[model samples]
Target: MTINTTHNCTEPQSNWIFVGVYSMVFMVGLILNLTALVVFFCYTKLWSHTTVYMINLAIADLLLVLTLPLRIYYHLGMHGLSQVLCEGVGLVLLVNMYGSIFLLTCMCFDRCVAVCFPMSCRVREGRKKAPLVCLGVWGLTIGASLPIYISKRSKASKEIQVDRCFGSFPVYATQTTAVASTLTVGFGIPLVVMLVCSWALIHAITRSAVAQTDLINSGKIQRMIATSLVIFLACFLPYHGTLALLYVHREAVPCSLLSVYHYSLMVACLNAILDPLAYYFTTETFRRKVDMDAMTRMFPLNSQNSEGNNSRAPVNT
Candidate 1:
């Protein structure tokens, strides 16, 4: 199913563009995710379901950001770079982008259950299940990306130039199917899940005295939802949309559209930076930054974690 097109088109250069973009993502994403990790480990005393998800999300973002240095190396016209390294870099980025989305969706779902169905068996049991879910998400995203790894291989072949590591790779029919499936499950379904979970959380917050009369908790919840949706749409939407177009009409691609596709990738990487905004909203990190009696409380802390960190806030329930 590998199809090679012989038509010559001047591929728009993206070396400088990715250089600027990856540098910014590396610096900002590193600082934010690291701060988040410290707060999760040091400041937070309880390991609630939401904390489990957010901590793992931070790790995913951290690992993803870590890959940018190598990306910068490859983009700097290093001809002697190992093709295996390039492929590994590509695989890491792929897993991070989709894995973060899956984890973010889990966060939303956890909140929804905590707020909307606090007394249900699901919420009570979620603490045990959250870690397993995170493991499953990483496993699934990596497994799903195998076909893409095979297709997007940048090894120097007769058709591929040694200078090209990021793009100008072969696209096979299986790769097309992989991309389509990723769009459906990776972005589309997660988008739907977040919206539904967000709606449920917001509705619960408004109806109940979520913080037992702290109106600001409502605002925090709303802001968390807003950040997640905004990041997902503004960052991921265009990247996936352009990918859809590229695959749909991969043959005879106009230079303009292909350029758009390349740049969309830069925009998509912004999630690594902006995602900390969601962390600030959803976790005790923001409230703990200021003087707050209870942290991350959609509800009060439960009996289990209520012992440690007199300030440790219970997840909303």
Candidate 2:
């Protein structure tokens, strides 16, 4: 049950590089997520199912970014803060991280359902169950992360010559609960749902497309979903898998496990950067929403029209 304290990565290259990269990411993510919030709220009436899921995802991302300052300070050698503050920030960050994963999983399922059975989607549209399901996701996410706040404590270590906050119980407490919760709430349940939904969606789409041959020709949609699943499996699976292994064999794990842990942690951070690409490409609505702006920025309508006969002819044709 005894947990060994490990030093944070302190190589000058890694430290400065992570600091710079995450700082820029924080700034851009903060601005973009804030804009998403504005779109969610100011244009509530204009929202649909995709927007609802995206708004929640953006909120979680925003909260995660908000906690980055404390992490940045810690990484930058501001260890003077009380252990309580450190644990507090860690708790919030963990919640948002897992919450985001689950939310995205939920969104994938929602998309699968909508694509696979449009008629059923419309049938369920006005039902109270739809909103309730979203509410359940939030509630479950909060419940899953509650262990971080509840079991967290600061301990002074004469052996390691450091005072730091850790989970209250290493054996049956913090680490165990975190892994179990993540496996169930963060990984097991959501992944199963996502796979099933996605499978159904793909099957239905393929079948319907072959039958009608003209209904859904957008390979982009399929590509988007496939890309999302690939990224999710690549980035998150390793991280969680490593974490689970660590939780199970924490005391006697080999150095290789620690290496995998570090690598997976780095990959997990890539999720934040990769997500914007996913959002941009997955939702056609998002593309259409920005089309006008993109066109204006790239080439003015008047200028295109002034090109004469070329304007009357279709650009693609």
Candidate 3:
């Protein structure tokens, strides 16, 4: 295989900065996703529709995190790596990125259904959809990413000789189509669906009788919606936003612009960390420990003569 040199790349040292970013994402994401999976499996009460999607999401995050070391190597210079490993890295990135997106979207949808269609939520048949959706997501994302094989092979900058895998592909008609279709399916569709579900969740919560009296429950619903939206907006939007910009540049994008895209991409990986934290907030067993009653029961000395009424948060499971 011939080595392709890109004179367009000048900032080789900048890769070190990105290495730090990827390293941080890997460490935090690994810890958070592992802890979430452990808690989900250990606690029987956590077996629910939402938990099903969450388990898949944690799996996706863990896999995504595991791949970061390869990305770190990509940034740190692989010294002419194998084309297969380079392509495999890109494939794993695509599958897990969109897999997590779909899983998180599923989670938001589950919450919406629980709030708006509680009867369906209680149904045994309805509960089975979660795992089925998880399976479909894994299949679909992997299938969607098969196109990566058609993309060009890895190339390194002549200045750095740092092999860049899945760095910036030259914009061509096929690549353009790929970017358009991926953005629409991977990010655009899920984003719209999540926003709609989140709105519906908020709307349903406000209209319900529980809204008038069950302040804690209502608050939980709000928190879930807020956190989900924040994760999508903060963690995903910037990367895809930069992707769209790259798409617009057409044919050839500036090396400097490619560097910016890489940075935004790393920032987007923080979702692996953020999503697990959301799990702690939204999961019933995890969230309930914060209630005054749970606190009083666990630490009696701290709650002596507490002023307000002891309104134990309702158990969801």
Per-residue accuracy of model 3 over 13-120 as CA lDDT, tens digit each: 337877888899899989878766655664334466776787798899899889888778877865566645765776787679889999888877777777678776
- Give me the candidate number with maximum TM-score: 1
Error of 1 at 85 (Å): 2.7
CA lDDT of every candidate: 0.71, 0.60, 0.71
Ranking by lDDT: 1, 3, 2
Report the C-alpha lDDT of model 1 over 1-317, residue by residue, as the tens digit.
Answer: 22335234455333877888899999999988987776667656676777788789889999999989877776665556665666677678868988889988888777777778768885677656998999999899888877566655543254644444555442431266777787899889999998888788777877786456855667766776776787788988898888887677676666566667767877877888887766644454445532342333323654345445456443332
Instruction: Report the Cα lDDT for residue 213, model 2.
Output: 63
Stretches off by above 4 angstroms in model 1 are: 1-9, 12-14, 151-163, 169-174, 209-220, 285-317
Collision pairs in model 2 = none
> With candidate 2 superimposed using the best TM-score fit, by how many Å does residue 153's alpha carbon deviate from the native?
2.5
The sequence of per-residue lDDT tens digits that candidate 2 reaches over residues 114-213 is: 6665677564574324456667777876776665556444233223433332212122222666778777768788778877876777677667746456
